[model samples]
Target chain A: MNSSHLSLGDSEIRIRMLSQVYSASYLTRKKEREEKSKLLEQLYVHDVYDRIASDFEEQQYQPWPKVKDFLLGLESGSLVADVGCGNGHYLNVNPNISVIGVDRSFNLLRAAESRVPGVNCRADCVALPFRDNQFDAVLFIGVMHHLVSSERQVKALLELSRILRPGGTILLYTWAYEQQKRKFNGQDLLVPRYPSVGEDNPHCNCHRPTTKSSGDQLLTLPNQSQLSVLDKLERIFVRPFNLFINLFKLNSHGDSIETGESKDYINSVPSTQSDTLDDKSINLITKCSNSIYSNTLSHSDYHYDSMILVPKEFRVREFPASSLFSVSKVLNGKVSVHKRDCVSHSTNPARSRDDRFYHVFKRGELENLIKSSKSNLVVSKCYYTSGYWCATITKNTL
Target chain B: MKILTHNMLTSNIIKSVKDGYPLKIAATEVQEVDVDFNPEFIQRLLAKLNWSVICEAITQLDATKDIELPENLTDEVKEDEDMLRKIHHVLLEVEVIEGKLICPETGREFPINKGIPNMLLNDEEV
Candidate 1:
């Protein structure tokens, strides 16, 4: 993973070649600035899956129908390699075609072995164990983005082309940065993960002080600005005393609050704090008081203990298909880049939350990517299905 | 790994290993599993294969006892069903369960365990 091992000549050429795919400015963005921490980022990306391999496998039993259809369309007995094949979900897509699944996670591969006994290889996509021009078709589904840099992504694509026979087909699935349902702050983000508490607590209710869910309770508090001079003067002296009384009331009725029967008491406490504060200050005070109350009550039979956020990070990159135009240029205009709008196929809600960066494709982005690459690979068919931008490209027979 | 997969792999991925192709197979265990025959698929696959390299690999694995393949594929041989089956057997059915794929130029041996070939190179090699 270190650049020092690469020969100076090889590294120079690779950097030059990759520069054609990524502009100098684009390359410097987060990855280079944080070069010292790159190893940590990689560990986060790989270790998160290792930790959650079981939960991830459970949510991925259903394969994307479009991908299944593509596999079925291939000629019988075709040798296919599914790079980044998590749990071998696509291995059984067609009994006629032979599939060799490869992944970096051993735990995920173990799950795949239980489902499909043979043909799973533990390998990285950057340097696959398979021979050159070996497969009739290759799949790079949900795999490229995991590579931390554009250079690695290009290298992976080249590796795919290296193994693929001339005139062979490649089925690629990548998360798009642009989607209809969600918005992103940047192309690179470290998505936060929250532990899942099954249907017993369907709402995932936790004490999120900033969320709008508690707006009603916040509105019940009094605004200090609304008080007259005499009232304000009296309130300053009474505020501390009221806070103590409220804390006593909360402890006395902790059981009632746990059962959702003490809304009246909870609302009353905020009203006392609101008397000496403006609306904004009242909100701050209410948040502080709630955290204190929740902390103390949580120790005693509260159901919110499971809501603690897990200290794990999943690093993800969202690529704007348009940005790949430069990369397509490096491929001699044989590859084209496109943007497509599609729903994300990730079933794990924790992985798809706002904190997680996703590059949801806008409609036609995938096709544009292939076309813009100007590579020999032509888009034979491209479409959106099962919440993914799916495209099948074939190397033109020269 | 099947000989067909071996036919497509090269150890030249690392700059140090030049001409790392046509790896000499030293298989300790070879298994022949039945696979559905598709004449058209084999015919298409034959064009992409390096016949001499494959022949050399077959010989190295000591699997030439039952199968006798010509040095080069010809038009008439393409029409021969028996020849095609033999070719198919050597390519897809013959699996090297345990062995080493020695690089022709560098003489570096990549180990194969339980039918999976580990083509990963060292850090400096990459």
Candidate 2:
């Protein structure tokens, strides 16, 4: 036996052994990730809504005209299922139809039960308890964005399809990336739901931002371009600290928590309306500014037993150095500002635990998702309405 | 939950179950809320619902009240307001305030509290 050949054989065995170890670690990491994602989904999406149910009712979200019109158009005695009927806002929109509301949050369902008694149930949208081909119409309004992944969203649509009768209509709504007041850095981001802030500032009388002209918008996202020189310098100094924290995470956990991908459709989508600041938004901001801080607690403050991990996709991209310096300084003291990168830094734990996870859809993303599922459904109508991508899909009768 | 809502519910969300239709009900608390009777609505639901499943659920409720739907829903039953009213009462009025929906195939139980059947599956259950 040649000595070199023997050494090569030994190295080959070592490499195989190393790969086995690597794969094992990878599997564990994946498992850990899945567990974390599930926990995050529960805490942020499920628990947050439960905590804020009554407050959500007080907001008195009037059904969107489009949704109301759709409901009104349905034949009398139509069997309709409102998939995420928070407080049953649209449950009894039309008394002519028999509508049942379903939601994951029991508190919200309880609230719904009070209004539209015995119509709402606590059920996940992805796994609805309904039998196949049972309904004339299904209303999936303002619910699709809460799901974390594309796969989950597709699963939900498929579930909806399964329950819908042949030729049944499904009215779907999700937050659009091209909104006026709020700016999303990516498809996935958190929208803070100030449950207590509304309760604390009862005099403020902040209404849920609706499609109507009289709608009152609250909580404008802090403009990145308005950062002061001091803030920018602080961010610059904070960058290395973030890096150090990530490096420490890498060393201890063998995985980096930082997200890198940022740009895709932020600036590409054209705004249908001008960027003028509405008066109702400003008034609500001024009135509720004081109570916002005390009410919005960080996730760590909640103190769950297990380790909580913000899924990588749910993370907002860190402000790049170039964009940081280039931002025009237009500071408005009346408005309260909150950082978008709430997941990255320990020092800036300004993020509201009430901030629900939202995967704001790109223009055609909703349509593409339905099409890709290969379900027997067609997008009969889809349009952007009041900062949401609204679509009416029909299940194939043939 | 109303028997009408229960008629559409299934336990097939559980991965182990192939078909979980017509879940068995065990009612601990039940109420009969007054809803406006609509024969047309009852007729529409009858077209979509499995008539036997509705009968099975109503029987499972164990209500002392004598609310009997036809053994088999016929077109004449659809036209009969008296029969339609019975279905209307069973479907819309009689509410299961507290109960458990037992999966037919797997015998897994889902709790119904405050008149809401929680069909949400846990991570392991799915």
Candidate 3:
């Protein structure tokens, strides 16, 4: 079932494996998240783009395949959005595209706006700041699913549906789930997975070698468990704080809540982004969610959520919206199994985070430094690349 | 120098960020001076720059050229001495005389006066 086109040399293999764990684990807490975001900013300017540029050099430095004429369409001033535009990878991918990239991570927005020339910033997906049907097309690309709860997932979709004008098309890509449960090198756990060629799959061939586990059939990982078993964080210690976070929306456009603008959202004057707590509630919510994410894999984990976009006027059916976003839309791009192959043969390989380079932060820490500061920063998720957490935190006024 | 160029440069980024593949420019005063392209260098630098970023910087500095970048190096910008010389002029030779370089993370400004950039950190920047 492997493609002839699927051969990875060596270094690419390590980078891909590293990229996986970072995306899955890094953003769950605060400390390492900050370091990773800033590190990713450095990688683009120094390491990645130049090398990646060679691969796409003939392709005009665009990371996506087959992109010339399709991107030319963007030149017409068609308004586009780069949702979760980490460091504006895709927004910056085609300089000709008339696009605006947005994300929840403020650090990345700063680095992205620095690298990219003319991208604009809006507030949040849970509640967008534009009028209804304002864009010619919207691009979800490699973002969505970072929201942890099913309600937040639904909230994001409903908001997207509302903003998309009639006939406005949206594009997205993300992780797809696999059906055949597999283990690594005869072990009981799975490290990572692509959607199994299920009985319903139209694209994949069900040809992988697998094993049976606890009366259930499973695929065998080459060496280690593909899916990670996370640390068990003490939730009771973090419960009350979680409530405060949900009650307050730093996102601002949601309703009467603070706009996350003025002197509140990192205004650096009377209040800071984190100090907007008239109620110490937001910190509680952040601590608890961080604890939960740090804990073992379960339903509440952000990994299991879905992110799909339906027109504001249309009702979706048949597909579980969660399943739809994870498998259908999110997994649309060409996957490089290069990094996975590296782990299969490494002298010492790890499936979970080898480091925190791929993580992004929650809303709180992003606000801490920015509340009263106005240094031209905005936040957005980046296209999934590098073994690092990517963000596009740039300033709107600058 | 543009802060954008500064962000990419770390003492170790060149050595460990990748291999010693490309020389990391840890420039103290990389002024983005306005210069006519040395056609040969633009051709040579074409291979070195992230084309999208290069084009973007070009757009920021000059937008009159049609947004045409070399799709494939062989078919695109040639290995002309003139082109490289021009690019060498634009990328390396240009002077960012008026602006200041800010820390990529903190937005702390470091002034560049008379072609000499001051990356000296005050207690606040540190």
Identify the candidate with maximal TM-score. Answer: 2
- Put down candidate 3 lDDT per residue, A83-129, tens digits, no spaces: 55655556545443345665544445544555553243423455453
Candidate 3's displacement at residue A22, Å, is 39
Which predicted model would earn the best DockQ? 2
Query: Of the candidates numbered 1 and 3, which has the greater DockQ value?
Result: 1
Give the winner by DockQ: 2 or 3. Answer: 2
For all candidates, the clash counts are 43, 0, 84
What is the per-residue lDDT of model 2 for residues A1-398, given as tens digits with 9 covering 90 to 100? 34455455596766666556655654565465346455557865888878777776666455666688999999887889999887787888887788999998899899889887777788888888888888999998878877765556767899999999999999997876555454333445545444334333222222232222311222333333324532653354334323211111122221110111122112222225444233344234323431332221111111111232222222223322122121111223343433433223223333344556666665556665676566898888766555677788999997
| Model 3 error, position B56 (Å) | 28
Runs in model 2 with CA error above 4 Å? A1-33, A195-351
Q: What part of the reference interface contacts, as a 0 to 1 fraction, does candidate 2 reproduce?
A: 0.69
lDDT score of residue A175 within candidate 1 = 55
Put down candidate 1 lDDT per residue, B1-126, tens digits, no spaces: 777767766777767765677878888888777877878778866776678877877777666555678877899888899989988888777777788888888888888776666665665667
Candidates 1 and 2 compared by DockQ, better number: 2
**Top-scoring candidate (lDDT):** 2
Query: Estimated TM-score per prediction?
Result: 0.55, 0.70, 0.31
lDDT of 1 by residue, A16-100 (tens): 6565544434334423323423332245455666666676544323465457788999886688999888777887788767788
Q: What lDDT does candidate 2 reach at residue A31?
A: 62
DockQ of 3: 0.04
